[model samples]
Target: MSRHIAGDMQRYNVRPNCISPFAWSRMVGAIPTDTPEQQARVEKLKKLGTKQIAPLASDAAADVTAQIFAVHGNEIFLMGQSRPIRGMHTSAGWTLETIAGRVLPAMKQNLYPLESSNIVFS
Candidate 1:
């Protein structure tokens, strides 16, 4: 979306960017952790999330645009756009059963951990 907007507005020199912030706002405070391990993880995350997000004005002033930025505490992390990490191709187009039983299992190492589905609000 940011790239599209920046491209469309390039003639006007308007810049657009995306912010992915890790902050301990009320929403983070509201997260419920069930186990000690989960709680510990949450607490550690809280440290990284302790600072408030910086305003986009500074980023604009710095002339940074059309990029994804991860704000962690006082740090400003400029990230490249997302791209595919890996791909798998089969001569026979995959069927539901094959994908579920073979392809997905092969990709298990790349999957993110999902300890508690209830932790995420959406």
Candidate 2:
């Protein structure tokens, strides 16, 4: 079963870390700068889908810093260095309704609920 799942997950390209704090805006390099409301847009998209998502383009980096991890039935752990948040579960991926369905679990347990989780980027 593990081998089978590994095969299924192998096709998904594992992107290295690109997420950074907002202070690193000057480090965008070749990628275009974010709009003034990028944070708010990210927050809005957080409600729509994708918080800890893979970068948009090959050159694109510096998406939102917030991320979801861990698992417990229908819950995703919103692991924050500053604060711990949780999300309601879904088929998979970030969605407000799914995030909104959070069923908070015990503290300091770094994990989230998913059917088959591979590489998680936070």
Candidate 3:
């Protein structure tokens, strides 16, 4: 969406960028810490304040567009744009068994863990 907006509005000199900011706000404070992992994640988040995200929204960042920035604490990370990381092709197409036996195992290394944003970024 940011890429589309940035392209469409480029002629008008509008640059669209996205910021994924994490801060210990009321919303975060309400997260259930039922497990040890959750408790640890919450503890880490507590160290980040809303102020850490201000710089990315400032005039200094006007030149940056169609980019996703992850803000944590005093750190600002320019995240990679979405794109295919792996691919598989076959002239025979694929059957359920083939996919399960071939594709799954081949692609397993590239799969991302089922973790929350807090855990992933941290």
Give candidate 2's TM-score. Answer: 0.15
- Model 1, range 16-81, lDDT digits (tens) per residue? 777877666677777778989769756856776534455664653456568786676677777778
Q: Please state the error at residue 119 of candidate 3 in Å.
A: 4.9
Q: Comparing candidate 1 with candidate 3, which one achieves the higher TM-score? A: 3
Clash count per candidate = 0, 10, 0
Per-residue lDDT of candidate 3, residues 4-116 (tens digit) = 78989988878778888787888899989999988988998898887867767787877877988888888888888887799998899999999999999999999978877
lDDT preference between candidates 1 and 2, better one: 1
Residue pairs clashing in model 2 are: 70-111, 70-112, 70-113, 71-111, 71-112, 71-113, 88-98, 88-99, 88-101, 88-102
- What digit string (tens of lDDT, one per residue) describes model 2 on residues 1-122? 13344345445643333233221222323333376555543442234333333333234533422233333223345444434364344477755654445532432265655631212422
**Candidate 3 lDDT (Cα, 0 to 1):** 0.83
Candidate-wise lDDT, in order: 0.69, 0.37, 0.83
Off by over 4 Å in 1: 45-52, 59-62, 84-122
Q: Can you give the lDDT of residue 30 in candidate 3?
A: 98
Candidate 1 accuracy as lDDT: 0.69
TM-score for each model: 0.53, 0.15, 0.66
